[model samples]
Target: MKAAVANTFDSILKIEDIAKPKIEPHQILVKIHACGVCHTDLHACHGDWPVKPTLPLIPGHEGVGEVVEVGSAVTHIKNGDRVGIPWLYSACGHCEYCLSGRESLCLSQENAGYSVNGGYAEYCAAHADYVVKVPEGLNYVDAAPLFCAGVTTYKALKVSEAKPGDWVAIFGIGGLGHLAVQYAIAMGLRVVAVDTGNAKRELAMSLGAEYYLDFKTDDIVADIISKTSGVHASVCTAVSKVGFRQSYDVVRRGGKCVLVGLPPEDMPLPIFNTVLNGVSVVGSIVGTRKDLEECLEFVARGKVKAIIEEKKLEDINEIFADMEKGEITGRIVVSI
Candidate 1:
């Protein structure tokens, strides 16, 4: 099989021929069709995150493909089933978090691209238990981003506790933020998109955002408070220290602020104001299987859709460069 392998930190991925992976008794062999290039994949290549991935690792978790073969012990899924593989590849079923159906928080969790071989190849192996069945009408390329970006934003909204007609501000209009805007609108909440420049503002409004605030030129805190009478909740999809702090000022007293982006290790929040206003600052990781299923259903029901850019597998390195510079909008899907 041919795969784009990450050989070293701060280096481009190398395409190489490697031995086809053998599946375990509980795993399935998927013929890779498409994989989404994510910010985390770029971070892994640059060694931004704490985990030092193994050399020559295949770094992609937002994968969609058809099942070519299933292990002998696998029963729920079979050959020819289309599935989407996400970051959470496996979790210890006996852990307390998993026992409570919060497998995303399992202490013993194995990430797909970070801890093991992932997509970005002709074929890949995945644990059957964590694989999500893609809807029949969606193409593999379109469904790729839903594995991570869509599910992440969807889960963040679910935990926000905002209801219809409430104001929900999404900070950042990039890949994840764009999806967050659509999801918020579908859930009947009025969305306020915060990002710099006219381009992002236009994009956000086109996606059903009621208001778009140019963070660079406008007083965002005042605009949000005035527009919606104070935001009910805010989802921070862009990882900026300043943006995180701004969320607290716009939200109503006792409102929720959720963090979905991976900020710097030493980033600090305004502890004094957080406690004084009775506001809750929550951190959300990727979704569980149940969350992923609900996300897919949202897509299937036309409640949400992913904005994507499609590229060939050979352009993986170029895609990363653009993503790092914030040159790409929406999610980038690599066709295998």
Candidate 2:
């Protein structure tokens, strides 16, 4: 099997021939056809987070492909079925969180591309219980990003608890935020798209954002408050601390601010104001398997679509460079 292996955190990923993964009785072997290159993959390669991925890792979780073989214990899925391996690789099913439908918070959870080997290879051994079935009409390249970027944003929006016709602001119009904008609209919430560049501004508005606020130019906090009396909720998908602060500031009293982007810096809150205003600040990680199914259904019904640029597996290094430079406008999916 061919894979792009990150031999060290300091160097670029190298394309190398590696032994294929062997599956357990509860797992299935998938022939990866396409994988989305997420920002988390770059963080994994550079060991940016406190919890570093083990070195010599194959980093990719938004891998969508066909099941080539099924293990003896796997019954629901079989050969030739298309499925996607998302971030939540597996979790202890008996944990309190898992039993209550909060499986992503399970203490004993194992994340794909982080705690274990993931896609970015020709083949992957996935737990049969976790991999989601891709709908019949969706393209592999298109369905690839829905595994991560799509599900993450949709779950964040659900956590925000913003009702239909309520004003909801989406911070950052990049890979995740772009999809967030579409999902917000589909869920009946009005959108206020926040970002810097004019290109993103256009993208957001074209996707049905009621207003597009440039964080660099417009006074986001004042402008949103003046026009809409503060948003009912704010979903921050930006990687900057300033974006987090602005996301909090633009929310209405008694509204929630859902944090999805994982910035390394700490965001300090005003305890007095937070308590007095009854505002909620919550951190939402990747979605559960059920969330993945619902979000993909949105795509299958033609309600949401990711703007992706396809690249070959060999161009993984260049894609990381572009990601670091903030040069790419949307999600990038690698064809395996």
Candidate 3:
């Protein structure tokens, strides 16, 4: 099998022929059709986070493929089934968080593209219990981003507790934020889309955002406060310190702020104001398997669409460069 291998931190991936992976008794071998290149992949390649991936790794978590082989212990899935391998590789099912359906917070968890070999190759093995079945009508390329970007934002909104007709602000308007706007509208919330460009503003408006504010020019905090008397909830998918502050700023008293973007440094928050306002700040990672399923079902039902550009696996290195430079819009799916 051919793969784009990350040999070291801050280095371009080298395409090479590698041996196919073997499945464990609880795993399944998938012949990959598509994989989404996430910013998390670039962060992994650069060793931006405290923990780093093992060298010579295959870094891709949003993988969609057809099951070619299943281990003897797997019974819920079979050959020829289309499935997705998300960031949450597997979790200890008996843990406290897992038992309560908050499995994404499970302490004993494995992450694909981070701790183990992932889906940048032609073949990869995934735990059968963690692989989500892709819906019949959703495009494989589109379904790729839903595994990570889609599910992450979806879970954040779900945890935000914003009610119908309530004001919800979505920061970033890019890959995940674009999907976030659609899902917010489908969930009956009025959306305030935040970004810094005309293209993103137009995209957000087309996707049903009730208001669009350019963070670069307009007074983002003031405009949001004036529009809906402060948003009932805010979801941040852009990793900007200033944006994080603004997201916290535009929330009404007793509102919620869900953090999804990963910034390298800690955010300097106003402790006194937060306490006085009774606002809650929460960190949401990727979603559980059930959350991934619900996120994809929104796509399958034609309520949301992942804006994606497809490229061949050979262009993985260039795609990473574009991602680092913040030049690409929406999500890019690499065909394996």
**TM-score for each prediction?**
0.97, 0.99, 0.98
> Which residue pairs in candidate 1 have backbone atoms (N, alpha carbon, C) closer than 3 angstroms, thus clashing?
none
Compared with the true structure, what per-residue lDDT tens digits does model 3 show for residues 1-336?
Answer: 999898999989999999999888999999999999999999898888888888978999999999999999999999999999999999999999999999888988888888888889999899999999999988788899999999999999999999999999999998889989999998999999999878988899999998999998999999999989999999999889999999999999999999999877789888999999999999999898988999999999999998889999999989998988989999999998
Compared with the true structure, the alpha-carbon lDDT of candidate 2 equals 0.94
Ranking according to lDDT, highest score first: 2, 3, 1
Judge candidate 1 at residue 237 and give its lDDT: 89
Write the residue-wise lDDT of candidate 2 on 31-109 in tens digits.
Answer: 9999999999988989988889887899999999999999999999989999999999999999899999999999998
Model 1 lDDT at residue 233: 97
Q: What is the C-alpha RMSD of each candidate to the true structure, in Å?
A: 1.1, 0.8, 0.9
lDDT of 1 by residue, 1-336 (tens): 989999898999998999999999999999999999999998877887666878778999998899999999999999999998899999999988999988999988988888888998989999999999999898898899999999999999989999998899999989999999988998899999999988898999999998999888999998888888889999998788888878767889889999888778445767888888889989889899999998888898888888888999999989988887879988999998
Best by lDDT: 2
State each model's CA lDDT, in order. Answer: 0.90, 0.94, 0.93
**Under the 3 Å rule for N, CA and C atoms, how many clashes does model 3 have?**
0
Better of 1 and 3 by TM-score: 3
Indicate whether candidate 1 or candidate 2 has the larger lDDT. 2
- Candidate 1: list runs displaced more than 4 Å: 265-267
Candidate 2 Cα RMSD after full superposition onto the native fold (Å)? 0.8
